[model samples]
Every structure is written in C-alpha cells, then in structure tokens.
Target: MNASRLLLGSFLFALASAASAATACAPTIDKPWVRSAPPGAKSLAGYLVLRNGCDAPVTVVDVESLDFGMPMIHRTVEEGGVSRMRPAGKLEVPPGGELRFEPGGLHLMLMRPLRPLADGDVARVRLVLADGRRVFAEFPVRRAAP
Candidate 1:
C-alpha cells in the first residue's frame, strides 16, 4: 500500500513538471506591430505572427493591452464591395504551426487609446490563452508592415 501511494505521488509530480515545461516553450510572437494612426485617433490596428512550438495546440481566446481600452481579435470581411470588421473568436494555432494577423485578415482591433500612440512608440499587448496562460509582447507602432 505504501509503495502504491509513492508511485501515485511520483506520477503527479511528473505531470506537473511536464505542464511547466510546455508553458516554458509556449507560442512565440514575431513582427508584432501596431499600425500608426493620426494623432488623437480613436482606434488603431495591430498585427503579429504567432508560432507555436509547444507539443499541444494553443488557442488564443482574447487580447488585452494597457495602452488601449478595448483590445480584441477581429477579421476584415468584404460583402457587396464593402469591408467590415467582425469579431474573430478563439484563434487556434496548431502544434508546430503558425498563425498570422495581417491586414484585411485576422488582426487586432484596438480601440479607445489610454494615450495617443505615435510612430516609433510601443504598445504592450497580451494574448490570453484558453488554458489560462498569457503570452505578452511589445508591439511597435509603424506605418507599414515589417
């Protein structure tokens, strides 16, 4: 009986260690940037490339930023020659795969700035995952893609 209990405890410890290791290699963001808007603009757009290196899939449930009052995942769609922004829910990145946030596609819709952000400024953003893990990045404000 004592040996069985010891084995179970060891298994639990290994499971916790594996969870920590997976988060340590969480998805990485590349080329994170916020499109530069005019001074006093009410809203802006942000873009990034997410590359998942974890052994399991990663699902981004929401976006948040201290620089903006409302940060969300949005996608641009066209209908009847008109373009519209729609909420994109739960973006998933497969293991060893990549997801992109580009213009006219999956992108960040940041609204109601806390302060005016200009070219060469930085916006701190956080991507909240479904498993309660958060990935953070500093997106530079730029007029063009880089």
Candidate 2:
C-alpha cells in the first residue's frame, strides 16, 4: 500500500511540473507607458510592447484602466488628407512574436479621463486575454514632446 501511495505521489508531481512548464511559455507584456495629457484634455493614449514567448498565438480581448472612464484598443488610419481613429477589435500576437503599441499606430485610447494625469504619474491598467486571463501593468505618464 505504501509503494502504491508513493507511485501516486510521483505521478501527481510529474503532472504538476508539466502543467507549470506549459503555462510558463505564455505571452506577456513588458514596460507599459502612457502619454500625459495636457491640462483640460479629456483623452490620452497609452502604449506598450507585448511579447509572445509561447508557441501558440494569443489575443488581447479587452483592456481596463483605473484612471479612465473607458479604455479601448484603437488604431490610427490615414486616408487621403484625412486621419481617423477606430476601434481595434482584437489584437493578435503571433507565436514567438511581438506587437508594439506606439504613436501614430496601434495604441490604447483612454477616453473620459477621471482625473488629469500629471507627468511621472503611474496608472494601473489591466489587459484581459481571450483565454480569460488578466494581466496587470502600471503605465507611467510621460509628457509628449512637441
């Protein structure tokens, strides 16, 4: 009976190790940054670099910001003598690849600012993955250079 119990314990340990190994290779984000809005500005933008270390693709479904009324993924498109902003449905990060949210490109649109964000202020944002996992990060507010 003791031998049988030992074998069961070993099997459970191996299973746990495998599960941990599989989860360790998931996509993650690093060094998120948000632009500081000017006084009386009602909206701002945020940027970040998402890294996919896994062998499978990951999709960013939604984003939540504690400092803004609404946070959504947005992309800037330039047409004939016109520039417009639109919602980005789902951001996909390819396997072993990366996605950059930068200025004049894909970025986070923070609307209806709850309070004016000053320089060097840190805003906490949460990104929800398609798999229902929530990744939290702190984005620092920086002045946009003219």
Candidate 1 colliding pairs, count: 0
User: Which run of 10 residues does model 1 get worst, by summed lDDT?
Assistant: 18-27
Candidate 1 positional error at 15, Å? 3.9
| Model 2 alpha-carbon drift over 4 Å, by segment | none
lDDT of 2 at 46: 91
lDDT of 2: 0.86
TM for candidate 1 is 0.89
Clashing pairs in 1: none
List, residue by residue over 1-146, the lDDT tens digit for candidate 2: 99999999999999999988766666677868888877888888998889998888889999998889988999999889798998989888899899888899989998888887899888888888898877788888887622
Tens digits of per-residue lDDT for model 1, 94-130:
9999999999999999999999899999999999999
In model 1, the Cα lDDT at residue 127 comes to: 97
lDDT at residue 30 of model 2 (Cα atoms) = 82
lDDT score at residue 60, model 1, on the 0-100 scale: 97
